[model samples]
Target chain A: MTIEDLIEEFDDLGDWADQCEVLIDMGRDLSNMSDNLKTEDTKVHGCQSNVWMVAEVKSEPLRIELTADSDAMLVRGLLSVVLMVYSNRSPQEILETDVRDIFSRLGLDRHLSPARKNGLSGMVTRVRAIAAEAVGLQS
Target chain B: MTTDMSQRPPFDVEAVRGDFPILNRPLESGRHRKGKPPAFLDSGASAQKPQCVIDREREVEEQFFANAYRGVYYFGARVDEELEATRSGIAKFIGAESTDEIIFTSGTTMSLNLVARAWGGKFLEPGDEVLITEMEHHANIVPWQMACAERGATLRWLPLTEDRRLDMSRLDEFLTPKTKMLAVTSMSNVLGTINAISELARRAHDVGSLICVDAAQSVPHRMTDASGQHNEVEPVDFLAFSGHKLYGPTGVGVLYGRRDLLCEMNPFLGGGHMISQVYRDHSTWADPPAKFEAGTLPIVQAIALGAAVEYVSGLGLDRIHAHESQLLGYAHEQLATISGLTIYGPDLEHKGAICSFTIDGAAAEDLANLLDIRGVFVRHGHHCAMPLHEVLGVQASVRASFGVYNSCSDIDRLVDGLQFALERLIVAEK
Candidate 1:
């Protein structure tokens, strides 16, 4: 979705300040990993919160799904922001997009804890690795 | 008609408070209602600068700004002298054996990285372990992990006890002969637990390992001397702390290594001022302090940091310690009475000036935001010690830390803001 669409979706939910909460809540709803799925294999490294991401590369384009279990709800929200930007994109698109630049545009860097920033970096790295594997398969 | 000033204790809290210019300015939001005041409680991250330190920095820049160690001009000579004097002052303040052992760097992170790269990276071998505690900030943990990774060494961690103190009882388990280095923080930034560095250093030495103490948290509020005096604790092999935390300017910090160890290690960064003799094929390096300091150092900031050390030292660290402990005790007692608040670290008696607590049913960021609206500034996060937070079973906590200038009134304002925030959260839930 475009930035405008995302902004509109956020604004429609509540006040501008509450939009973050709404986004976080959306993240919470999207993140519903079962206990059985919360294995070491699915765990995302370097996150202060326990995040598990499982993405499948469909035939036409990449489709990814992620679930995070964190005592802190905001971290779950942050993970959701990551998913919205990365999931459902092709490997080429995923690698080309500037994730750090997007985070800068959204002012996510200032609002996030250093650990969360590192977590975001870890998430980006994992997604890039997955994308690279997919591209290698096609080549 | 004069007030009975003599009746008060010899240490003047209000006088000490006046030195910090940030306290007088309007809060960052620049607005206040009647009978409301802004209280700052984020000293655990970095402290507000005193006017003396600020003025010293400006004076250096405006008058004597020049590159150090290689200039023969008037400004260069003066700047070099000021830089060396600051080195001596820092070395004296931390109780180091000599100024030669002290190296200035960007901050604590760089200082720790220098050690990890130079000493830890060079000496440590495959199958050797570097021991650190769960309470380490990222600056302490990441460097060792990186060094170990590069050197094919193992990294081991000592767990934090339930009370958040370092589990020293199991120290022997981690201090194997294969352990080349033990790095730990003197105080926990998130939980405020004070680790016994001397004890840990003794244990490491017993097993033929050296200890590096991250004194970033302790140096600010307590007396920390690298030179072991009659009553002072024994010095660790290497100690690192930031200038900003101790009322000095940012972008300057100190790394105090034992002279012998510093001579043994290779240089971390290579550039001008660090080399002794150079050719197209080979080069020789300078002695300890100059060898580690690669380029033209942060000369102005270093001089200002010396002024800061003098300013704080004049007031006496013992007095500062007592003052902070008093405020911390009162803050702990008051915060404990608040319902649904769970504090990390040992009770006020066993900790330093930091207090990290979580309000039941409210996110730490949300609580911090609410408090911010009320002009009560606090830090809300994992505090760069995420592993410690994980061990404590908390994702984030609201930290209210005290410095030399903090008073009981500041604590009162924090309590008032917290109570209001809790009320609002509870009402919204209903």
Candidate 2:
């Protein structure tokens, strides 16, 4: 689903549980990244759960796609939200996207605990860094 | 909620709850502070201040309103009197021999930093070793590391046993003479393990190395015996704990060191109030305490901490410990009912009022968030002990810590919230 479509879906799901179900469902749909690709170079720290995210840059239209996994169901659910925003997007678009605004719009900022908010912030940092790396954009 | 545990002896929890005005406070959300009974379970981090402590602070600040130890005026005199009274009170609270032994700092972190920088930096040399455990909070670990790097000293580690207690089996090897010092927590904040500091202190003493106990987790819950104790075990040379952790205000902490050690050490921070006399390029420090308290003291916070001492002392540590242990047992009993929940501490009588746990299929942060929405606030994450968590084989965990104000009903609410969070967070794959 497009990021906007997923945001709409989250809005439709009035309850926190329903929104979380969508996150886990998205995680179930996300392709498993190989362990070889989950090296120290790709592992993102500061997550409350073990999360490994990797970015692929392609030159056809200068696109960057990200795939990630987490040890905890809730984190995977949260990652799905992150992936919906940045995955398979152009490097320019990914770099330009305001994930904080997205998190606020989703009400995750108010709903999530401080620790989760920080971990999600870290995930956003890692993703933006990857996109910025691909197109040499300033973060 | 279990009525049996709540009605325990020596602790009147309802009365204790009355002391803290902030308990069951309104919840703040989305620009509006709404209503919710504060199920504050994060005393593992910082505690709710007692109403008496708050009143005392306001009174001191509003009435005294003067810099201490300098002004010959009545206001300054009152500030000095109250601050020193708090100093002595803290000394008595921790079983210190004298008030000179108590060095006030910003918090546990700053107290430890003083121990590392002022003491370790002065004494440690090349090839000297400092030993600490995996259970140490970053406050205890990082300062010594900084000292080791600066003075060419090396650092060693003590591992955690399977039951989450410190592994003391290899004490002889770890406490070698080259090991000039050992820093250890008196209790594990995350695991809730009550360490035998006296036994550890005696061992370190036998090996000719002093030990510094981080009693930040212990002092708030139990009686600290820095004086004579059971088993004929001598007190450690130094102990540090925070005011905030003990139901006092923040920005005040106590570092109790042996009198001689304080006299011998260089000051951590160099400024006014700590010096005896100052030259253009050199300065000599005053005696213990003032020698260490270089800047304007956190007068009101420290005085309120004295009131906190009074409050805790009035309840009695044994009673508080008993009440908490009973509540902890009830929580352990209840949380154990959930099949996939993993509690991380050993079941022991002396354990602190803390439970750090994780569910098989849920994130610690999410679980804490779920509880938070229900107005049951808890701490989640590595709890500043990433290595201890690494040893436990988890990235983070949810911690529910208790204070004198907490009741069995709080634990009940917590379990219900956890079950609710689990309903959605756990997939069938679990």
Candidate 3:
């Protein structure tokens, strides 16, 4: 499915259980991170989970990939949910997508802790920075 | 929500609990089972407001709400009176010398940002150090980092010991001459560790550094005098806390600064109600509190906050603390019996009512979700301090906190929910 199609499908879940199941499926579907890309440069600073995200700009569209490891299974599941909307989009598209609005539509923000919210923001920041770099702006 | 007086002495628990309508109501999401009532275990994120505070807010909005300090009509005067009364009430509650020392902002985050921008932004230079512990909420941490980055200052962290308390043994080493400010939390929202503020203040003072306390977690649960005048403890230079956490309306908070220091610092935001005289060339600013209170204040919310302070004070903080302590002790004992559940914070004697714990082999989010299915609400994740979570060697933890309306039975519900969730998870794995 196209990223947009997948997001729509994920958003169709009626309750949190279905949402979580879809999130796990998304995690299983995520493209693996290359070993060379696993470095401090790709690390998200403020997340409790060890989330590593890397972005690269090719000719037509930018590509974003994320891999998160946590002792906690649901955090890994949450990272999968974050990646579904965020990965494999142009930098500008990533910035303009209104991730928070998407989260609000799913009623996910209420269930999240303040730290997870910050982590979500941090992920957005990381993606935006990569996007800014692709467009030749200092982040 | 009514407490039985026959079981114990008739404290004002009933009257106090009655004020908070949310305590009696079911959760917004309903109960776990079809017939069972919802049990709320999360008061740490934000608290449910009392009906009195809410009604007061609505009353002000309907009758007396107006732009404070700048209005010329009768409504404006009434609003100004109500707004000023909030400052006075806050000042008195915190034992400040005068209302001029109190500044209203959107909430604790903005209040702390004011200190970081106005005080740290102006005074701190490159190479100056800002000392903060690992346990601060992001609201306290990010603002200082922003200020430090702007001024080319360096940020220093005070480490936490094995027990999750601040490692005070090396406190002197951290408070060096380069330190211009020390910002710390009075009570950690995640770990529930109440630091020795007086000792911290004294240490900061000895190094000629100003100390700012984030009392967002402490002010609601205990008797806190941030004003620095009435107590023998060396006064904190600035204090910030939110109204919503203290059973008041949201969108309003207090920032207490020493009068002279407030007078010396520039205002953080500017639009209206902050200037004495305006002109094209130059406009003179008003005095301290007015200078900081720019734009239209949250007048009705402020009035409700005043009422909230009155409500909490009437319950008597000493009695409230005693009641919560009893619940905390009971919770600690029960939680200790659960295998693979590791609690982080000071010992029960030193901690407040907040408890953070991680269960083995189960994600905090999943555990929280399971607890929700059992009609128990809890906060799961890093609790806004990612650095502290990293220090604690856990990805995230489930936090169950208490408020004035909470009782021992509430803790029992939480424990039951947690045990049930753990068993269900184990069964599902099997």
The numbered model that scores best in DockQ is 2
**What is the TM-score (0 to 1) of candidate 3?**
0.79
- Tell me how far candidate 1 lies from the true structure as C-alpha RMSD in angstroms: 6.2
Residue pairs in steric clash, candidate 1? B94-B225, B94-B226, B95-B226, B95-B227
lDDT of 3 by residue, B39-155 (tens): 566777788888888889888889877777767899999888887787888898887888898988888999999999999878999999999999999999999999999999999
lDDT of 3 at B315: 70
Count clashes in each candidate, considering only residues at least 3 apart in sequence or on different chains.
4, 1, 0
Misplaced by over 4 Å in model 1 are A1-139, B1-9, B28-37, B230-232
TM-score of each: 0.79, 0.90, 0.79
Summarize candidate 3's per-residue lDDT along A41-104 as a digit string, tens digits: 7777766556676655564444544455443445556666666676766666776786777777
Q: List runs of model 2 lying over 4 Å from the truth.
A: A5-29, A59-61, A112-139, B1-10, B26-35, B229-233, B427-430
lDDT, residue B369, model 2 = 60
Per-prediction DockQ comes to 0.11, 0.31, 0.20
> Which 10 successive residues of model 3 chain B have the least lDDT summed?
B27-36
- Listed per model, the TM-scores of chain A against the true chain A are 0.79, 0.84, 0.71
Model 1, residue B427: distance off in Å is 3.4
- For model 3, the docking class works out as incorrect
lDDT winner among the candidates?
2
